[model samples]
Target: MLPGPRRLKRPSDFGATVRRGSRAATPTVVVHVRRTIDQDPPDFTRVGFVVSKKVGNAVTRNRVKRRLRHFAGDLDAQFNTDVVVRALPAAALEPQRVRDDLEDAWARAFARAAAC
Candidate 1:
């Protein structure tokens, strides 16, 4: 599980990331990353996961979320950014593949952020 301070908790936080974050997708998941300029500390990054009913029942969704959180755990503290990872149905059956995809997505997201 993501630590409390590093997890996105509110509906608005998800909405903001969805609305404004730069996005990248793999076959099994979509990623949205939003960087903020005035965020305090300047090195905290928060990560959230979204796995809907389309992905699975509660048990499956929670499993996928746990896998995603585990992957996000490896990320170093970066500039203030909020990232949302949305899992697709296929993700329910593939943990390692999702992790590989997430690694690619993170690379792309950071590259995009650096351009601006």
Candidate 2:
């Protein structure tokens, strides 16, 4: 058998961690983040992606999700807390552009979390 793509499970978990968390906005992305002070196993911090039909067909949406996942992994070290990243329509833009936007949004989200 093959392993499925590693990803966060449970909407409730994402909600609880970043419900009232801070938000960072960029031209192409918006990131919502919250600190998770409680965890039983503390296995790994998680992230979620939300892309809507407005972005495009299945392929475009999946591409955006993949990009977001890669971007999230690159920023894993910075995210000491749990985060939920919601994709905006602009995410369908060029790959490098999307990456830049996400990086900016993440920086802002991290800054906000630190202030709290």
Candidate 3:
């Protein structure tokens, strides 16, 4: 699990990140990356996850979410900006695929962010 301070818990934050941030999508996940604002800790990068009913029932959704959280926690040290990862239905079927897609999405999203 990610530490509380490193998690994006507000609805408004999720909305803004998805609306204005750079995005990248792969087969199983989509990633949004946004530069942190002045009020946020200069060295801390927050992460949030979106696993909707469309991805699975409650059990499956939670499983996917847990998997994503673990992966995000591991990758947290590498991120310099806020990130939101949205899981697709495909993510419920294969953990390996989800991990691969998340990495790809992160790379692409950050690359786009860097270009701006």
Pick by TM-score: which candidate is best?
3
**Clash count for each candidate, listed in order shown:** 0, 0, 0
Residue 2's lDDT within candidate 3 is 90
Instruction: Give the poorly placed runs of model 1, Cα more than 4 Å off.
Output: 38-43
Q: How close is candidate 3 to the true structure, as a TM-score?
A: 0.91
TM-score of 2: 0.82
Expressed as tens digits, the lDDT of each residue in 48-95 for candidate 1 is 889999987999899998889988889653467888888988898776
Ranking by lDDT: 3, 1, 2
lDDT of 3: 0.87
Give the winner by lDDT. Answer: 3
TM-score for each candidate, following the candidate numbering = 0.89, 0.82, 0.91
List, residue by residue over 1-116, the lDDT tens digit for candidate 2: 11133354677866775568889988778888777677553445567778889888999999998888888777753545667788888788656788888888888898888889
Full-model lDDT for every candidate: 0.81, 0.75, 0.87
How large is the C-alpha RMSD of every model relative to the true structure? 1.8, 3.2, 1.6
- For model 2, state the Cα shift of residue 10 in Å: 0.6
Evaluated at residue 14, the lDDT of candidate 2 is 67
